[model samples]
Target: MEHSDYDVVVVGAGLVGAGVAAALAGTALSIAIVERAPPPPESPAWDTRIYAISPASVRFLESVGVWQALDPARIQPVRRMDVSGDAGSRVVFSAYDAGVAALAHIVESGAIQRALWRRVGAQENAVLVCPARCASLERDGKRWRLGLEDGRSLSAGLVVGADGRDSWVRGHAGIGATLEPYGDSGVVANFATERGHDGTAFQWFRADGILAYLPLPGNNVSVVWSTPEAHARELTALDPDAFAARVAAAGNERLGRLTPLTPAAAFPLAVMEVEHLAVNGLALVGDAAHAVHPLAGQGVNLGFGDARVLAALVREREIFRAPGDPAVMRRYERARREDILAMRLVTHGLQRLFSLPGRLPAAVRNLGLNFTDEVGVLKNLLIRQALG
Candidate 1:
């Protein structure tokens, strides 16, 4: 390979990376995706983990030329969202009330990434480099030089660190982050519900944690339950049938009995906030920028939103300014900082407020839910905010 300096070098070829790469493909810019792993989700199956993508995110993916490549049958649109509290405090959201056909769509994260990569691979100016690991990235005046582990070097006007939490690019670029573990573990699993979900996503606030049921295609749904690490381990370790029954019972048989379709898995829950999103000619996006709890299921959607805003700015500039210029990158950072901060604080507060060891919170929480349910305008406002 030659020492080619592309216009943009994006690290971490996950969904966010693919979005960024595909976004720049429309312009005359040269782009490269650097990753340690190849494409994932060799094929679509019941065992693949999924994500509940928002409508705005779907539109962005469509704009960048990825959504059409995804198999429509494999995706499930969420027509209704039901949220409740353990003490019988409950609130329900309908897409009809928000004047939309669906609240979100649940899709296999790997499949979407693979499909996006397929689109990105077809771009003439975009190069997909596998097993390309970044050793360090340093600012050289107006440009950033990326040194890779394969004993090769390249320089670009902009370097995007989509490398996820513990981003080496962000570290090398001198960006600091504040990370706090919420002492929660997000346990994910897929299941086949006894009855069709009718395109509804359900969530419950229990004493242990927040449990959400996102619809999958047909009679299946994806589950995300957050709780203490010990409880999460105990739950995931349960025999398949027992685990399924426990989940079904916890959710009050909303979709009836569930049979586990995928092995239960758990990842530590945390909220990470980066102090600086841009340094020199490098900027961070996706998990490299921030990671909130999975209760809201907006983590990946937020990353994709970052790609949309940042790329639009680059495409609109139409000047000699590099995509990675500090000024240009700051536009991306500033656009997303408020949204990220709001999500972080909201999720963090709810996790703590619900995790409290008392009855007062439980009582007051249900009241809060009831109040929100009563105020039609506030509920509508929240739906609009989420749409963005």
Candidate 2:
């Protein structure tokens, strides 16, 4: 216990990485969070990147202390959500029906990352290391040796690669990934609406893309347009007024008018499913472990879910096993596989079914939504399950 090296080392300083570090901070383990780039000196006011945080995720963040620190005014509660198809089929969910104040919140991605980092900053057992590049990972008996570009080396009982989609640790661990583009780009931005959102989020399953407007902190809302790269760029290039008009029309004028809040940009859509999440003296968490269709808005949530389960396992373990025990890591991976796999199938299925203009599948899909709408108990259960 007199070692200067950490007991646990977490790579990546984003939401999931920070959450994992903070989650393990309560334990006896000494943890370190490594990031290739240092966090922004000044956390930006807003970011084009957005995330739909589910209720479960909100509770987890609250448990970790970030929720209390976030400005109340900056958190947008989604009282209602409207979902529909281009075929004129739709359904709406109200917080009253769910008996919850909000189904979820749409917050700037940067805000949550900062929140987690801030929470982790208070951890007496965790250290934040940045501008550190990982050159190689060597697993010796019962431990890991982390080589960095800074001409320094550190040893840990466990090394976690929460790094990201393009993870050096995953490569170092010999884990393989299957990545493929969805032939689309997700164009994301915020907007000023003529009318208040009333805490309602809207999503449309269009033939060419999926258009969603998530209620923001103010009267504003954020838009995510997943469509062909050309269309995405075209929308991003539109002037404020023209863009607002076009967005309104595309949304069927659901929220009245839309105005860009941030400079919009298009990111190529892709999905990465890793073969396995564990390696010798190493385990993967967050984007380093899996990637899902963004259309579901659970990318980071899935990563956090990984963090939650992994942290629980480590904290509750009876033996003094390294953080990266293959047996223990498998338990973590197994705990998450069902949830992550279900989400992957659901998101992928929705994207494929809605993106196609078919006769029977469209009817079936629409019918399914309406069916779920009518079945109150079933719908609630499904929502709860989906949020998890």
Candidate 3:
């Protein structure tokens, strides 16, 4: 097998891994990105999988030149968010009130991946290894050597696992993860609305589950309903028109009638926590490190945060310290623990609180929402943290 060396080898060229490569583009370090599949093909049709990119992530993408490459027409700014509880309680947050340009930008997952791929392709010190998989991994003193399925061996000072929930790299490194399945699936689809979204995002926590209407360009919105497995399967099995109508009614027809723009899909929901975010020569990013319930719409944002922080830490490390040094990796893990824990706690707690069958728990949760809505200082604080 041919052998190669790099300062860093990132597994999985998904959004977070590609973002990490992009973030480190101008640095002096050599980088390699290994992916099991080629970059997603460009398409005229909108992707059903969408993400709400936080302002902090926007800055990170902008720094790497990916944000500027995205088509402005395909991006939608979330100016306001209207959240309602099952007991007729509601809380509204406005970007203007938070003194930000927009709460977040709604972007297609494929668009971000494509843009990042383009940047990585042009990066001077980065190489993309498409259709490649890591068959095995071994420690080479302070570095890690990866044996690819294609008969290539690559050694790197650091190995990064951005390979999603079932990370092959994480498993190879012997990192243990605890997974708490939500026993539900997140159903996603896109639709054209009769009335304009006006840059407003809506979310409802009902007895059935949590439903979110994320605005898109023009009279369109992307829907993500986190519901039980049976309900999710039933929703995906519906005819296009019936599915759209069901979704429209679920949101109280807030956006008027709906027409399906993409076929519905469902992914099982779970919260995952790794025993450690980093080891001597390996580090985990994105879903490889942690995964939280998506009810807060912070899953991708957190992944981006991981990329941003890990890249920064590596770049700013002491010159005497190697990238894979245990001390250096520990710092990255330590810096991320609080943020990951906080998100998991919030999302999981909300899910449990709302899932209770009794009327008292429902009333208490709704009352809390109403109380938070009226508290300006508290709401701003929450928005500020989310903006990060």
Runs in model 3 lying further than 4 Å from the true structure:
318-321
Query: Among these predicted structures, which one has the highest lDDT?
Result: 3
Candidate 3 clashes between residue pairs 3 or more apart in a chain or in different chains:
none
Native-structure RMSD, model 3: 1.1
Q: Rate the local accuracy (lDDT) of all candidates.
A: 0.85, 0.82, 0.92
Q: Report the Cα lDDT for candidate 2.
A: 0.82
lDDT of 1 by residue, 365-385 (tens): 888888889899988987776
For each candidate, give its TM-score against the true structure. 0.97, 0.94, 0.98
Model 2 off-target regions past 4 Å?
A: 1-4, 41-45, 318-321
lDDT of 2 by residue, 73-111 (tens): 778888887889777787888878888888888777777
lDDT of 3 by residue, 1-388 (tens): 6999999999999999998889887788889999999766889888888999999989989988999999999999999999999988999999999999999999999999999998999999999998898899999888899999889999999999999999999999999999989999999999999999899999999988999999999999999999999999999999999999999999989989999999999999999999999998799999999999989889988988889988888888635446677776888899999999998998899999988888999999999899999999999988887788
Output the lDDT of residue 27, model 3. 80
2 against 3, candidate with superior lDDT: 3
